[model samples]
Target chain A: MSALAEILFGGLFQGSLYAMMAVGLALVWTTIGVFNFSHGVFMMLGAYIAWQLVELGLPAAVAFPIAVVVMAGVGWILQASVVRPLIGRPNIVLVVVITTLAAGSLIENGALTIWGPRSKQIPALIDGNTTIGGVGVSLHQIAIIVITPLILAALWMFLNRTRLGLALRAVAQNEDASHLVGLNVTALYGLAFAIAASLAGLAGIFMGGYRFMSPVMGSDPLLKALIVVVFGGISSISGPIFAAYLIGFFEAACSYYFGLYWTPALLFGVLILTLMVRPEGIFASRSRGLA
Target chain B: MNPILTVEGITAGYGRVTVLHDISLEAGRFGNVGLFGPNGHGKTTLLRAISGLLQAKSGRIQFDGQDISGLSARAIVGTGLIHVPQGNRLFPDLSIADCMALGAYSPRARPHEAENREKVVKLFPKLAERWRQRVRTLSGGERQMVSIGTALMSHPRLLILDEPTLGLAPKIKDELCASVMDISRGGVPLIVVEQDIEFLLELTQQLYLVNHGAVATEIKPGESLDHGEIMSMYFGH
Candidate 1:
């Protein structure tokens, strides 16, 4: 019973991180019609920025938020300079893949060149451990479990309730219609990237507090996030959030039973089977959308 | 009286194939104008050029005396020129209420959102009952109402509608025609492109027959909306 509880707890914690990472990827994809390959690097870069801020003797709270803010700026620039120019060009889908992939590669190398290859950890929001329902878990894990939903709820409200959020969704649904409705489509696209990047940054901080982070630590999480997004459905914002928890639990069960080496294989197999069964998505319907 | 919008010798197209060749027309401040033509000729293309959705490869467009050829579609909308394009191009997942909010997104329109929304609801009373319903659940007629209602939320000085009644039931088309007539009676000028010739004639005072990407004919006042004459005048030339 205790082992089962622990496994479930681990899944929940892991899923929170995946949800944070995947939503950004999904937002950019739905809004701009391009997959941002640099999203992983945004995570690594965010963690590094937080670490540097902490090293410079700032409080973790201040440093963490500052890092997320910086990532937002970086994301805005990425859209303006890289993504915006490529829009309206023929074969933009293929071209964006190459450009963002190259941009991610460059940023990854820049992190390595500047921060060195040594894995580093940031101070956790809480320094102690706690027992929850017969499972031993870090308070940081508890923090993640608790905080992620609030952030997600905030995001949900922003997308559904606020005027700007509604406008962002309008852009996602029909770009030309959005323009006709008087939305600044370019600015909204940039806003989507910025929000996605900031979420990735916060997820990075959460991961860095628990596990060590290096210039390349973003890869594993990135791959998982991509799977979660594809598995859930890229059409609606809620789809990936729902899938992340399912995958998180699935991964936990696999880790406990089949072991670590088998988790990826099992996850990939499940993804393939899911795709074969429902090519549209696990949760998306035609009427469901980001707006 | 001065024209509200003027397009002078504008030529635009998609890519290398020019869809609108040297198309020019003027819209008066007091009366609605209708553009009619065969499918795939240039009626919709001309609307696209006027609204700043397509940049003219050459020539100028002026709206309310502000040379607006350089403005983007969104910027053009700030001047209260709203386009409710064909097919009720609303986000399917968005609720009617949310759609209305997005319709008034610009600074120029936001201030009048409350007042304009009242007028829109008055124009389409069914919309008030279906406020929380997503656009996907709306019927063809209801979607058209939301499309026009959303445009009205922008507080348009001059409204442009492309095929607002296409693919609707005859009953629904009559309902929409009544609402559109009320809209014109409310004093906002309209640029309507519709396949329903009777609807076009009843709604607009000035008529232009667009053919092969140019203004092939312009029927001034004293011209009757005689179906036979219009058919021959448009098809004969």
Candidate 2:
């Protein structure tokens, strides 16, 4: 019983981080219609930025927001330079592939240029441990779990209630229609990309404190985010958040009962099954509304 | 009356395939001009050219006595030329309010977003009723209303509607046509493209009959031909 509780707690906490990481990739894909490969690199870049701030003796709270801002700026620059020119071009597959390759190259080269191939661990923001139903849990881990859902709720409100959010949703649905409605589509695209990068930066910040930072740290979150986005539905924001929780819990259970190797296998197995059964995704059925 | 829009020797195409050849039309504020032709006759293409969705290979377009041939689609939209594109092109996954809000996407429309939104909901009261409802859930006619209302948000000087009544029931078509008339009456120059000459003949003053990417004739409907003759002319013998 204690073991189950421990596993569930751990999984849910890890999944929250996954949700943050995936949000950016899903956003870029939905709004801009580009599966930005550079999404993971953005995460890496964010983590590094936060880590550097810490090295500069800045507090974690200040560093985190600054990292997000920097990442957003980076995202804007990337979209302006690389993504804008390719808009309305029919070759979406090539664009996606190019972005993915570009991201990977950034990661490999960036690590060498900046961090010098060394893995760095961040000092946990919330140190010490707590017990949940007689199961030991770190305060930092619990904070991560609580914070993920909080961010999700905030994001939900932001998208539904804000003018900018509504515009982004419109662009995601139909770029041409958004344009006809007098939307500055280019600006909207830049804004969406920025939001995505900010999310990635936040995720990276958490990743650093939770474990360690390195160029290779990006792949784990990226893969997890990919799964969450697919599981949630490419078009739905709420779907990804829910999918993250589910995947997180599942991963926790599998890792506890089986082993580390069985975790990926089980996740992949479930992902495959879900893909075969509901390719549009689990949340997609309920979200059949307009763009 | 001063011409609100003037197209002189405008030629346009997608890729190497030319769709409009020397196609030109002129209109004044409150004027409703109908482009009557069969499918593939370049009516939509001409509107697209005017809207800057497609560039004119060789031509000049003057809107309100200013050359606007070099503007991008976004820029042209900013100049009060709102295009309600063919096919119920609403963002299917978005809500009614969001769909209507998109009409205020240009800089000129931003300041009047609140006023325009109120006007849009008032015009299509169905949209106001289902303001929170997703666009995909609306009936085809409701979606059409939203589309028209969306275009109107820009306070358009010139409104170009492509196949406004396409795939609609006869009753719905009548309602849409009435709305178009109402919009034109409100001091916006309207260019309507329709396959049905009878509909245009009833709704508009001047008609341009297009054939093989060129204007076959520019005439008044009630004068030179009856409804049957106009149909035969557009559809051919």
Candidate 3:
């Protein structure tokens, strides 16, 4: 029972982090119709920037925010220069896919050149652990658990309570209608990309403290986020969060009972079965009301 | 009287396929103009050009005495020319209330959102009754009301409606046309592109007959020609 509890708690913390990452990807996907292959690279960039700032004697509080802001600026520039120009052009999807995949490669190689191949360790924001139900959890794990919900709550508020947020939703639904109704579709696209990148940055900062950072660390999280979004449904914001936890627990259970190697097989099996059975996803039957 | 909108020699199209050629028209303040033509001509294209959805290849569009040619659809909305596009392009998943609020998204309309919302609700009481329902759940005519109601939330000075009566029952169409007449009578200038000639004749002060991407003729209300005669002239027997 104690072992079971430990595994479940660990899964919950990891799942929350994946949820943060997946939610951002889902946002950009639903809004802009681009898969954003470079999403993970943004996360890597965030972690490295945060680490460099902390190394330069900046506090974790200031370092993380600066990283997030930098990621947002990167997002804006990427959208304006790369994505916006390709819009309404022939073969846009193919063009964007190639462009973003190339961007990911560039960012990954750039990080390797700058930071080298050695893994960087970031100090935890809060040190110590707490025990619950005969299982011990680190403060970093607790922070991951708490911070994800706070971010989601803030995101919900932004989408529901703000005009720009509503406009974003409008654009996601129908670009032509959004334009006809006086929405600056290009600006909304830029803003959505920025917001999505900022979320990735925040996730990276948290994960950097919780685990070792590497130039390629973002690839795993990126794959997990993609799986979560695919499993949850493309258009839903909350759906991916729910799917993230499910995948997390399943992976944890698989690793505990069988082995770490069996976890990937099970995850892929589930994804294949889901695609065969319900391509629209479990939660997609309900209209994506306001995400 | 100074016309609120003057479009002259405007040519526009979608990606090398020119749909409008030398299209010229004008609408005065508090006046309604109708564009009547067969499908696949230039009625919808011209409206798209005037609303700034499609760019003009040449010539000019002046709105409120300011040159507005080649401006973005978003900027044109700021000038108080709201377009309720065809197929009732309401965000199907959104509540009617949210849809209406989103219509007032332009900076110029933000201050008057609440008041304009009230006016729209009053204009289409059916929409008010189903304010919380998603737009997709509404009937075709009800969705039309929400579509126009959404446009009205922007407090448009010149309202352009495209095929508002499409796919609606005749009873509902009559009710919507009556509501539109009431709106036009309340002094909002209107440019309506529709296939219902009788409805256009009843609702519009003047009508322009379009063919082959150009305005071929202009006719006033109470013209000697009846609906059948106008139809024969426009569509041919």
| Index of the highest-TM-score prediction | 1
The digit string of per-residue lDDT tens for model 1 on A1-291 reads 887997889889989999999999989988888899899889998999999999999999899999999999999998898899999999998999899888889989999999999999999988899787788889999999999989998999998888998988888888878989999999999999999999998999999998999998888889999899889988888999999999999999999999999999999998998889886679887543583
lDDT by residue for model 2 (B44-75), tens: 88888888777899999998887889787788
- What's each prediction's TM-score? 0.98, 0.94, 0.97
Candidates' chain A TM-scores: 0.98, 0.94, 0.95
lDDT of 2 at B75: 86
Clashing pairs in 1: none
Interface RMSD for candidate 2 relative to the native interface: 1.9
Q: What lDDT does the true structure give each of the candidates? A: 0.90, 0.80, 0.85
lDDT of 3 by residue, A86-182 (tens): 8888888788989988888998999999999999977787889989889888888888888888888899789877888888888878887898789
DockQ score, prediction 3: 0.76
**TM-score per model for chain B alone?**
0.97, 0.94, 0.96
lDDT pick, better of 2 and 3? 3
Candidates, ranked, TM-score:
1, 3, 2
Candidates in descending lDDT order: 1, 3, 2
